[model samples]
Target: MKHGRALTITITLLITVLFAVSAGCTGPVQQPSASPAVTAPAADGSSLVFTDQEFAFELRRTIGASYAGEADIGECLATASRIQEGDFESWYTEWNRTADAFRAAGDGSLAAGHRVSAMEAYYRAATYYRTAEFFLHGNPADPRIVETWSKSRDAFRDAIALDVVPYEIVAIPYENTTLPGYFYTVDDSGISRPLLIVQTGFDGCQEELHPYAMEGIRRGYNVLTFEGPGQGEVIRVQHIPFRADWENVIAPVVDYAAGRPDVDEDRIALWGISLGGYLAPRGAAYEPRITALVADGGTYDVGQNLLQNLQEGGGAPANLTEDDLQEWLQTDPAEFNDAILGAMAHDTGTRWLNENGMFVFSAASPAEFWAKWMEFSLAGIAEEIRCPTLVCAGAADHFDPDGVQAQALYDHLTCERDLMVFSDDYGAGSHCQLGAFAQSFAAKFDWLDDRMGMSG
Candidate 1:
């Protein structure tokens, strides 16, 4: 696999890249609607035939190149592309080459650092594909999209498995079973190291592949990442479902980490995004070992956001009346579970799920979606966190209520916390801020410096 390993040296030699629940407050400029969560519109069947033609041009421009997506992205800019208006073939190609190189660089080599770099590229590629999909251009029910995504998932998993562990105990739980994660440590001889634990958002891998872990580590901390139930690896491989008891599961990881010889237990902080925004505060409620928590691009009510997506999905549920939420819990709970299962099965529909991944629904039907989501919302628990926290939201965040709910969470926290709405100046997208790569980590690293009072 190492020989076939396709790791991108650029991203590692180059880039690295979450936080709070309703630490609701204000951010900078954002997308127009209050909570216009992104959604993948069904592809333009008429124009899709042109995909072949588009691929012709794209293949010529990006083949064997590191920046495949650049071709399609450039076309959009050069021609003033509309929503769902550009080519994906060339874009997807660049994405694959970049990530494959990430893995190829570190694949089973004596140089262990590249292994982490490979995982970073692998993870970024997954995010890049999903982010591009959200803007539109595919058959929501298409099978080819599923095939393409499977390829990306395999690439990321390959990177994850190839790395060596620096820690003695690296456990990743999959329901009842626990698998050990690889370990890593900073070479610097700082006194006690700041222990950084990362909690990823929906469908995220716990390898610091996402931007959050990258940002945290770049700032100088011993960052540990692992997949929890219903997240990246857990769902994809173990098939162990997600449960509401997220904190209980994380407590064990924190406990294991705090006991490590390499870590300074006092500086432990947890950062997450999208749905993890909801899960992190809940986890903090029980495990206070975590000193700082960040709700990146805030979200107060996870369930409410899901409900809004259902309504926007043109499939408003029948039980959406005032007492609808209460009535549904008394009724069937998993009616719409298939909607998610179906979406996860197909890549074309992934953006639909990613845009609205963190919430649950009453049913998959047009009638019961909204009410069901509100039932699962975690808004009521924001008051439990007592750590010095930071809540951030890109002005154009897809989760609109992020600022509002983030402030609410901030007020509820018994500890000191801050809220920052990123300036429009940062063109970082809602959840997958590829553009803010270096800057995001720079901010997080600085934040850690402040908290640790490391100004020697």
Candidate 2:
């Protein structure tokens, strides 16, 4: 639904990429596994692998959330049994069915004063509702998108209302409006503590970031998570597209947090996931208030990454430099749109990527999307960051299979930095370590603890 990464088109197989948010996983790190070799072509002109890789990956993401109580193993399996393999409508139908059941159960529990049960049901309902809305971006005018997203946000808020720790729905001031957010504090003692600012990437919203906020709270750190322009409420309600200069966003967030009595201005950390990997570092480069930074699945030069993926998949000519690609996009807009849109008709992942990209970035055409993507590069910005940064990379990341983006960011950083390459042996090799939230969060927060001297 939410592809956080570039589309990779293989002969007869398209690898789906989600460059946003964590799902779940549990384990220790180990060496990387050997690449999956493509079997010999059969008489039918297809590889022996007969699977809808995109659907399978999304299913894994759903089931993986069970580890955090965001889903139930049996419930997810039962839902999958009814979903038609690659049919987006079927996927939405089944997930929404389950969400309705869960929401009803939560209502019953709350009516009986069973707060704990109500909390769990509400959380799971939120996740299912979010999943149901994933594939609806293709039609921007779909009413189901807003209805489902609102349900997810409302469910999450209801669940958190029953939590032991303090949680507040906040409105962080921006230029002409306020950004929606959730603020979590370790306690109500009014003591100043380090704050971890968690922001969403391409597809996920602030609600899905609840687990990360809880993790921060457990580690004696306050957490603030919000949806920036082009994400969550900002895009859905305000219709503001994403901006290349992210410092403006982070600076206002920091101002809001610093004004709070519980937040330590000098010990704040900025952690971004998926596309946030690029956005966070981009902001840290200019925002001097961030004491530490984490870019999960670090990205540098997203435009180049997209172009390279297209080139490798035969969607673009080989060795097309940035200048060449720009010239072609401007000179032959019709040809560019035809090539991309034609490919989208047959591939689910590509279609979602293009459609979602256009929706969030507010691009009217594919060529314009590519041009806007070029503005997000961190070529000369990485060196400007002064905070101690942790750049994370999955050994088998679909979008950055070779860890090129992470390496580029890590290599360019002049500040104290660490590059963490998570191996696939631990089930943490996917983009943003979607199925390995536990291992990913443990490693990420551990680094932040050491940097901030919060280690126990």
lDDT of each: 0.47, 0.77
15 in model 2: Cα distance from truth in Å? 10
Candidate 2: segments with Cα more than 4 A from true spot: 1-50, 309-320, 330-332
What lDDT does model 2 reach? 0.77
Clashing pairs in 2: 4-18, 4-19, 24-435
lDDT (10s digit) by residue, model 2, range 305-402: 65665667775556567666555554436655666677677776667777888888888887787677677888899899999988877765655656
On residues 1-456, what C-alpha lDDT tens digit does candidate 1 reach at each position? 121011111212111101212223223223222123222222222232234322222222122112222123343232222323233444445444553444354353416555555554554444434333322223434443445555555554564455332232367543468744434455445446886777765544453343344344545567777767666445445545455657877787787777777788877877766566666767876787978876664556645443344444434453464344335433433433344334334432232343333322213342243333343344556666677776665444433423455555555555676655554343332342334444455554465567665433
Please list the Cα RMSD from the true structure of every candidate, rounded to 1 decimal place: 12.5, 6.1
Candidate 1, poorest ten consecutive residues by summed lDDT: 9-18
lDDT of 1: 0.47
Q: Top model by lDDT, which number? A: 2
TM-score of each: 0.61, 0.88
